[model samples]
Target: MRDLQLYASEAQRYPPESVRNHMISNSIVPIARQFNEDMDALRGLLPTQTPCPLPARMAFVRNKKSLEGIIQRLDHRKIAATNIIARYNNGFHLLYLLANLSRLDGFRLHCNILSAADGIKALSVSQDALSQTLSRRHDALEAELQGQKAEVVEGLQYQGSKTSLALASLESRVHSQQQSLDELSSRMSSAVASPDVLGRMVRAELRQQLEPLLHRFADVSLLIDQIALGVSKKASEHSDFKTGGSGAIHGLSNPGSERRVIYTWVTTYRVRGSQDGYFRFRFVFMPRSWLCSTGISLVFSSGPDEFGHYSICPSILPIQIIPYSSPVWDIFERDDAFAVRQLVEHGKLGLRALTEFGQNLLRHAVHDNLPNICRYLLRDSGYGTLFLDDADMSMEIPWSLIADRSVEDDIESTREILQLLRAYSDSGDDSGNQSEWGWNNIFCSPCLSFEQKKSYGHLFLEFGATLRLFSWIRNDDMELNKSLLNFYLDTGGDPNQFAKTGIPPLLFALLLLSRGDIEPDISLVTILISAGADIYYIHDPDNDPDTARTTTDWAFALEVEDLWEAALEECGLDIASVYAESDRRLQDHRRLRGATRSGVDVESITEPGPSSELRRRAGQAGRRCEEGWIAE
Candidate 1:
């Protein structure tokens, strides 16, 4: 026992250096070697400067895999080293020095591991950034092409119209010349003194007049042919131009070039024609968030297939484009803050709305989970607050979409999202406006009935979510709403407060029992009374005919039971008048239900309303006196 105790006890004497050195060599040296290898590999993977677009896809993928492998391997090493340093004890005085050295080495390893992780993130952001750039270029080029195409179609129509008008004028001149010739022939025939001489005079005059007119007609026909040929040549040139046409407009011909056809004209060219068709410009991307709509889409449309209607379309361009060249979702998934920041800094993905506010890459972040990327976007990115874009689906917003969602972080991340919003609340936004994104209305969504929804509701309270609660129950939760109800009461929700809805605390409780019925849970009623609910509760929706129908309006009609009245009396308030009025209304079921019409007869005959088609057909067939009336 003494030998065992001595072995376990702390040794005051210094252990020999040789023994400690062997232990360190066996354990710590391998870890140090691995740390160096990982660091070297990571440094090699992340380039010193950001690639403009990105390297070839396969090369990028290879580097990405290498960086990720280093990160994972180093993470495992970090954890193993931490455990070793924590529990290391050989009970030798000299080994303390070794443990301390190992401790310092572990710190260095951790730092290297973090550095390697960041490189992985940069690689990802670069990839996403490149993809986004190419997509934007494609859209921009297509828009320019469409604009140029519209101009061509319009120019051709205008030139064709001028040609047609000239042809009409030439034909009119020919008809007038023929009329003059015929009239002269008639007069000559009537006034002739010599038949052979007169006949020769008429023939000579007709041929002379008709010759130049025919030539003029032939000239107009030739001009029409040239115009048609020009159109065909322009079409072939268009095919080639598009292949190399990235952003080059006006590739057709220089306006001042003498090479222009003597017959060609572009002086009156206007986009889509002044009187041509109009377009309702639409975007081609799925808007990603309320604070952003950064989608890369080509919302193409085919307009009226007529000449003047050939409106020139202009493609939309971004103001502050997202510059991330790679997909960095891996960074978000890891929740690595440093790596996320690297991506943000390197990619320059700040407050960019491809068009305007309430459209960005935020939806992508939330779709995965709450991560450091969201933090940079909401707090660090200078975006201020992510305002709700009404144009998007409600699921795009954090409050409505997340806590009730089936994400990995579940309720915890959902709360963090709300807290993030709280930190970035817009001072310019009106918190009192319950219909929008703010305190008064922190998403009373149907999705609020989620598992953690009751817990999620408390986040709103922490963030200063106000409730009119006529004194209680703010959560959409069925069971845990009691806590929220009390939260409202404790936080100064007025139990007797009546508003336009006319639902006081007392009647409001009864409405909670079910959808159109007024059955109050006694326990809940007592709780309301403790919170200072009015026992009388006189003025409700029942008093105002103009009031919109509400659940309280339905509840007040269910006759107040003697038990309820007695309970109120015990609380030192009389609801006798309320009971009597409710009883009177309840006696007449129709009156109690607030039936819109006085009679159930639908319309009371009203001088025999229009007959049903079936009934009309029956009457027409009525005892048809064997008449063909039935057949007719």
Candidate 2:
């Protein structure tokens, strides 16, 4: 409402149609887009069940058709949500949709979604509050200013009366002093009979004539002394220079004297409103005080790092350094759960874009070792998925953050964070959400130090993280040692565990060894065999030695056939029989491949080629493999 008037006042510069268009495009359009985004986030959190069986999910979609209608109305260029767009019906629809999110328990979530809810409510409340503030009858700042001005006027009137009295007294004292001067002049001219009599007579006349004026001078000196004493007391008791957001003017002297500026200030008020409004930006100049030779252009950093400016303002646009309000990031450091929830729940996490802390807020909390806050963000607050922002390792999920060894070692706090992450993993419904599978890919990228890997690797795996650790061969960190692998096994990582790709770690490690990234060690092969890696476990019967070059080929490729045989022998399996069985398996694979191409049901005709009991045990130890992970 205030913006409409503000733009209306710009009539001399912009056309009426252009002004309205600018308001709609600049103010209303952005607000509507944010509202739509908040809606989408709420929809994502909304449960499928109508009754909202779980608030933890964020929000349940109450009506898909209505949601689509709103989306279609709002998508990209076809915006309709505004004050005067469609016979005023558009606003009703928006309000109703917002209401659906509030009051109803289904609209609220314990997580970041609540921020969306609070944000929606704040939107409504802020609109109403702003309207009231802009109304003609409700000019709080102007009214207060007017009231102060009235007191100042009254004080000035009283000051005028006191001035009049002081001037009158000054006139009376001047007349008295003039009368004494006349009497002294008269005494000096008076005649004396004898020489002795003349001297005595003149001195006696001077004393008699000057007594009243001398007493007046004494009284005047006492008054000046008293005034000086009072002024000194007042100066000591009170500060002369005052500063505030409104504005403060300070100088070296009072009015009508030479003034040196202690500080300089200027304010701009709403020149078009019914009552003068105080919506302003204060620009306090510190030109010579703070600016250096190059300070006007370049900024110097004294801190370790700085969060970037998350503004829409372009680099082409000139920006001035002005006083800004306390940032939300600073507020996050307050450690108040209520304040944190207030920020997250009020849609700040979802709706606000420009106000986003230049860093990943969740990462900040984790770095500070605030597990309780982590719990709120990860699970309770509807803060959305951790894995989506994969571009920045520092800003996204704690996969790399947990691997950061530079952070102070507080195992107890770290353990709590692990527990929170585990709970977050379990509560998440990963049935169709493919992004949720990012949780399972913990150990895949071995980017952390060997010590870091040993410290948190086991805990991550044990606390619900699966051992789907598979990084590309070139990116593999070859520095990983035997102790770390042993730690992973001791904690919970079972290479023989249930998985789709039963690519045995034994073969995976041998492939790494063959790449010559790490120094070859027979113990690397021995360690896997000791940890229950099935050298005889073939994931797929079709993984033939000749037809498909698989990890199984790596043993022969690296000339580790001796180590492979020894491992089989140690696992109480016959090397001769295993090789013979592998040969038979290769032949059967070819037969099956040919039969399948000719439209035969290979599964129906598939049979056990060898009757050996040892082969059956190897098959039992490992079976599932499509992408080559072996599991018992």
Q: Provide the TM-score for each candidate, comma-separated.
A: 0.32, 0.34
lDDT of 2 by residue, 101-162 (tens): 33342323343345444544555566688688788566777898899999999999999999
Q: Report lDDT (CA) for all predictions.
A: 0.44, 0.44
**Model 2 root-mean-square deviation:** 43.5
**Candidate 2 ranges with C-alpha deviation above 4 Å:** 1-360, 363-369, 372-409, 418-463, 470-480, 497-502, 537-546, 549-552, 562-574, 594-632
Cα-based lDDT at residue 419, candidate 2 = 71
- Error in Å for residue 581 of model 1: 9.9
| Candidate 1 C-alpha lDDT tens digits along 1-632 | 13222322322234756356323223544565576677667656654543323453335456666766877886676666555544556534434543564466457646654554565567688779989999999999999999999999999999999999998876676544433432111111133245445335534533332333335446433333333343333333322211111011122111212321111111111233366442333343433232232444322223432342543563344434332333454555676667766755786443343322223455556545565666766667655332222123211234333333442255566556666655544322222333122322332344444334445556544545543543234433444446545555555555555543655666666655433333344556655655544343333246443443332244445544544555555554445444443343333333434433355545321111122111111221222311322100
